[model samples]
Target: MFTTTAGKPLRYNHWRKSYFDSAVSAAGLADVTPHDLRAPHGTWVADRYGVMTAAHRLGTRTRA
Candidate 1:
């Protein structure tokens, strides 16, 4: 689970872009956003199983 510096569980809140940009740059991932982390897992699962099954396992509802 994510937490703040004050030792409280991180609930809903927006983080600054500079914060994410610095982390990404430090990790040496160029042009990567926080949201990009999910794409590889999603694609791997979907390709291995199926789109519908992967969506269900991911707890996401998809029409197709």
Candidate 2:
């Protein structure tokens, strides 16, 4: 569901490594990967619902 201005699906690895890394680095989070962006979200969802539901929200399959 995510895309670039050219209407192509944003390449996950490239977007994460290039764009997201640079932005977070500029914001002083040099140690964070793009995937870390989901930590707070997953935590909130997990607290409100459960780990299984949080995983589902992140499109993951978990046995919790």
Candidate 3:
């Protein structure tokens, strides 16, 4: 249900740091970016659980 201000459906790669920077400023978060959040999420899940668990959370199947 995500859409841009232009009323177009939001796609993952469409937004860049400039877009996120504006959003973060509007939201008044001290400092955070998309890459900052995504990396640790992957690392934490994989480190604590395993690759298979991470893949499952991301809706991918473990292959033989």
Candidate 4:
């Protein structure tokens, strides 16, 4: 759900190259992809909310 400076939707390849890659490199991280942030983001949400909330945020289905 990222957008370009002009407010157009950002394509994945462009975002990966122009934003994600640059940010990771600037942060001194290597070999990290956007998908790699999921686990930590889920944990952060779950800690403050709950597993179900995290699941919803992550678009994951959970058996009840």
Candidate 5:
């Protein structure tokens, strides 16, 4: 069990590195990090869904 900043027991940070590394290896990619996923996910959702949705999910304002 892991504890958050608020002291709630949760499954956290256990497999984060392993999972990220596996994805990078499987995709034959380089220097990929969790932050890297944010850009593509935001871009895809903005493209397929809408700019507002993507910006909301990414917690950012859309720009022209």
Candidate 6:
């Protein structure tokens, strides 16, 4: 959840280009996108909690 200095939600494109990219570049990470972080987060959640919890956290539906 990122917000602007004005306390408004940051637009995805603007945040990606202006903030995310610059931070990633400064950290020396190459070819990474915001969506790329989701997998590792999901994996960590699933491992620590469970698949259902991870799915819930990720807003994904589980099959019955």
Instruction: Give lDDT per model, in order.
Output: 0.75, 0.85, 0.77, 0.95, 0.79, 0.94
Please give, for residues 1-64, the per-residue lDDT of candidate 2 as tens digits.
8898889988888788768888887888668865677989999999999988889999987664
Off by over 4 Å in 2: 59-64
Tell me the spans in candidate 6 whose CA falls farther than 4 Å from its real position.
none
> Which ranges in model 3 have alpha carbons more than 4 Å from their true place?
1-31, 60-64
What local lDDT score does residue 56 receive in model 1, on the 0 to 100 scale?
86
The weakest ten consecutive residues by lDDT in model 2 span 28-37
CA deviation > 4 Å runs, candidate 5:
1-13, 61-64
Q: Candidate 1: which stretches are off by over 4 Å?
A: 4-6, 11-23, 57-59, 62-64
Ranking by TM-score: 4, 6, 5, 2, 1, 3
The TM-scores, one per candidate, come to 0.45, 0.57, 0.38, 0.82, 0.64, 0.76
RMSD of each: 4.0, 3.1, 4.9, 1.8, 5.3, 2.1
Which residue pairs clash within candidate 1? none
- Whose TM-score is greatest here? 4
Q: List the residue pairs that clash in candidate 4.
A: none
Worst 10 residues of 1 by lDDT: 9-18
Ranking by lDDT: 4, 6, 2, 5, 3, 1
Candidate 4, 1-64: lDDT as tens digits: 7788899999999989998999999999999999999999999999999989999999998888
If both were scored by lDDT, which would come out higher, candidate 2 or candidate 3? 2
Would you list the clashing residue pairs of candidate 5?
none
Model 1 alpha-carbon miss at residue 23, Å: 4.9
How do the residues 1-64 of candidate 3 rate in per-residue lDDT, one tens digit apiece?
7898999988766775548777878888857868677667877898999987877776677787
Residue-wise C-alpha lDDT for candidate 6, range 1-64, written one tens digit per residue: 7799999998999989998999999999999999999999999999999999999999998886
lDDT of 5 by residue, 1-64 (tens): 6565678764535446546678788999988778888999989999999989998899987576
Question: Looking at model 1, how many pairs of residues clash?
Answer: 0
